[model samples]
Target: MIRDWEKILLVYEQAVEELKIKFKSIRKEYRNTDEYSPIEFVTGRVKKISSIIEKAKKRNISIDSIEDGIEDIAGIRIMCQLVDDIHRVVSLIRDRDGKDLKIVEERDYINNMKESGYRSYHIIIKYPVHTAFGAKEILAEIQIRTLAMNFWATIEHSLNYKFKHNIPKDIKERLKTAADAAFLLDMEMSAIRDEIMDAQQIFQAKSTIVAKILRNIQYLYFSGKIEEIEDIRDRFFDLNEEGDINRLKEFNNYLEKLMDKYNIRKLI
Candidate 1:
């Protein structure tokens, strides 16, 4: 019989946490460099003991072999904004194979949708985790899917649970229809992905400039530059209302010089 369930679970938990941070860091890196990131967000979970036992029994996996047999005990999910982004994330994971993790298997459900209308790309990997005992390797499942695909899958999962995996035929048909609709939405979004990304970049740049301007104004307030603060604040509001990013950037630059003149440290 398998003993030390706590210890086993602790390792899985650690793996999930570490994987989440790694993927999230990738997203942060892209943003920091002012590039579009394929990864929209990441989430992870260690399977609960009860769910693990249920799955093991359902799959005829012996308790002693559960550690090796249950590939998703440590699960990480990467959400992408577009269907193309899903493949990009998979490529990223593949690039790290043999270094950070070893790919044991891959299932492209998006291209080959399950009979139940499920869609996702699954990569089963062997990830090594360092425990107090030693460096032990464990199996983890990484699922990459677009936001639309995730929404459909989430609803299907809940329905499967509620209906005990025997959803009524009518409900099943509706779910399938919804799945196709979701995929269609993904395709449409991918068609205009470039336009969408450009818009987002512009918005991000404008937001950054606005934030810096606000910070400079605040610093001026604290530095007791009361005489010049009103004019600067008025110009900021006017430039903001003009809705011209270039003008805003120029104004921000002027604020930077003003701060420099006063020797006020920039917050950003």
Candidate 2:
């Protein structure tokens, strides 16, 4: 049993690394550019391995022969940016593995979730794992979520752990409220992303100009132009105080009005 556990762990770790690389490549290739890294998603699976063993032992189940019956995180979740992206990612995963990969089970939690619950996608995949000792076939669970959905799920998970589902009424209500907020935030974020990207481009451009000025000033100071640097330093401080990023959005609104009046390109 100990050897089996060790073997399982070894195989599982390698599977996880392989999955991580695959996920990263998929994210990059498809430009799903949200911050959901494979490591972030796979930690739950690693933790569930021990639990799966324990549960199997209780049921007098053969660990080697177990399917979804004794598996916990043999399941995977893939959080996507959009509903369509979820399906695309799933299809990609199915097609990418050249080995003996089998799609054993699937659950579309997004369409199937109960009301007041969050959304996600789940898949069970059976894949061959090769080790120095031998080759073993195992099942893996894949879960996918949108960025906002992932955030809500992660926070809800922590809350469940902290409260153990015996949460007070008020806290439970607050969680529901927060879930609603997360949903709204997701929509708002998606809507404003293009504008944010545009602003980032402007910021990057202005920042380049600022960098050049600072470098020139530094050069002057290094060449013993202390008094001239002091003057530039004062101007630098003034600019810094004026260009505070917290105030930029307000300035952007003003720029919008000015751009409207002048019919020039808007500033961020």
* Global lDDT of each candidate: 0.91, 0.61
Per-residue lDDT of 1-268 in model 2, one digit per residue for the tens? 3445554566776776677666666555432332322222333355456666666787888865555465444444556554445666777767855554777777786777534466677777777778888887777777876777788788877887688757678877787787777767756766875665456545654565556555555555555524555765776667667876434434334434534554443222
Task: Rate residue 252 of model 2 by lDDT.
Answer: 39
> How much lDDT does candidate 1 score?
0.91
Model 1, residue pairs in steric clash: none
Error of 1 at 105 (Å): 1.5
Per-prediction TM-score, please?
0.93, 0.58
lDDT of 1 at 168: 100
Kindly report which residue stretches of model 2 are placed more than 4 angstroms away from their true locations once superposed. 1-4, 30-45, 48-50, 53-68, 74-79, 97-100, 188-268
- Identify the leading candidate in terms of TM-score: 1
Over 1-268, each residue of candidate 1 has an lDDT whose tens digit, in order, gives 7578877899999999999999999998887666788999999999989999999999999999999888999999999999889889999999999999999999999999999889999999999999888998999999999999999999999999999999999999999999999999999999999998998777777877888889889987788755878888899999999879999989888888878987877432
* Global Cα RMSD, each model: 2.0, 10.3
